[model samples]
Target: MIPLLVCDDSAMARKQLIRALPAEWPVSITQATQGEEALAAIRQGLGRVVLLDLTMPVMDGYQVLAQLRAEGLSCKVVVVSGDVQEEAMRRVQELGALGFIKKPAPAEEVRATLQRLGLLDLEPPLAPTAPRPELALKVNFRDALREVSNVAMGRAAALLAQVLGTFVRLPIPQVNIFEVSELHMALLDAQRGQRLSAVCQGFIGDAIAGEALLLFHDLEIGAIANLLGWQPQNETETSEMLLDLASILTGACLSGIAEQIDVRFSQGHPQLLGQHSAIEQLIRLNRERWKNTLAVEISYSLEGHAVHFDLLLLFTEDSLSRLTKKIYYLMEQE
Candidate 1:
């Protein structure tokens, strides 16, 4: 039997890829959570076909592909990522990926790719089996939230791109419900080893209220200002530039989400939490103030620029009941 490997930081993504495989394909599957592990597994002759994800900690899929090329390893690689920007696709292909599949891939697309690669024989498609009702509902709800986040993020990205006069690359927004204390863990990539500058804006409406935070690495401020066509000569000028950028992004994102959920938000003024502060310490100060929260994290990177930042929307636990209802209603409308 041929060995096939799935490499992604997300367990959910790996499971989806497994489920998407042809039922009769004669292959043993292996999983790796990062690029280094995936490389090691491939070197050990563990996989002839690899499913890869692009964004990961420690090492990313691009680095893995570079290493594979350098070692003259021959393996069929298909990139599976939520970073669907054209540049990303072209980069992976240049690095020798056999093909690209965007994230939240439909099972049919996966099967088609395998068949096209001559890895799977063309066979009649399997009859769809109905999922358990509860499981189906859960999946629908999650997908709905993701869809909403995707739309809102695009709207925000568009505005930012317009302001900076550059294309903005957006990752798939990550949505989760967790205790307030666990918030810091979810932001490991964004806050890793960087003193962050953050701004917070609160919004409230009938039965729903939340906060939106914009986080930037302190070192990136100068590049960000230059991108915005500003030359800040003083600390105050730099601070103002940061606040302006944060306001534009946060307002557009929050407003877009609010419009979709059919709620009008009364937004508060944006407040700088502190400059050069640890993300954990900033959140810890408010730890007792919040319980569980539904967090939507969006990371934006500028194409051809060194500026990258994170936008985190935090909805309070009490607001989730209404938020879920709104999402369900939006799903129905779709």
Candidate 2:
């Protein structure tokens, strides 16, 4: 049996990758939550082959690859990441990775990759003595939502990077169930007295209904406009730039979530919520309408700039149960 390490911060992602592995392959698997642990495991000769993830808190995949090369650790690595930006794959390859498999990994694709790497013999099937159960992942409601949001945010970041010609740094999304009154406190990005501008769009499809909002720091507008080669000379031009950015981020993110849950969302035209408004005021205006909300807040920043923004998805209480049901169905599938 082979000793393989699956390193990813998200439990859901780890489970998905394990599911994508060829069931017929004989292997002993070790799970690592971050690059540091993965490195430790490799040093112990536990990782003959490593399936690595790029975005993690303590240490990222790039750091792991660099460390492996520095220590001259002999191990095969295949990067599995949600961040599909072009440079992501290129950097991994340069750092000594066999290849990359993007998120929502398909089982056959994983098999094909391993076969190409000469890691699997697929032409002749070997029957097992008994049935092997799928990875036993006890994912709760919040983590499941976070995983969905994680994949969605990655797609949005890739889209924004292409539009602005820069890399977008992704953070694990914060998922919560909040009373209308407590919602504003969660958005602490505006606490430094930085004024904020926002765009809001409403979406509805089948049992899913939510609002997608993009909150941008007023100060970052000029830098963002400069990147897109649209220097905002006037208030109207600045507003136009803000709208364009919101459309790209919110549209891509919302669509990503919809695709995961197998639904189609018809989004309303994004409206500029307000310029230079407090986050509290923004939440308060809609507070009376909702008793509770399931919020998935994704924060993103540019690679080399102070450009930062928050993409928020607010789902009504009525939609929460349906959303979790969909997640359960997703997890149950082969």
Q: Which candidate comes out best when scored by lDDT?
A: 2
- Tens-digit per-residue lDDT, 143-194, candidate 1: 5676567656766777787788777877767888878658867765677778
* Candidate 1 segments exceeding 4 Å error: 122-209, 216-222, 229-306, 320-334
**Alpha-carbon TM-score of each model against the true structure:** 0.62, 0.94
> How well is each residue in 223-259 modelled by candidate 2, as lDDT tens digits?
9888999877788888888888888899999888889
Minimal lDDT window, size 10, model 1: 130-139
Error of 2 at 39 (Å): 1.2
Whole-model lDDT, candidate 1? 0.78
Regions more than 4 Å wrong, model 2: 121-126, 129-134, 188-191
Query: In angstroms, how far off is 324's CA in candidate 2?
Result: 1.3
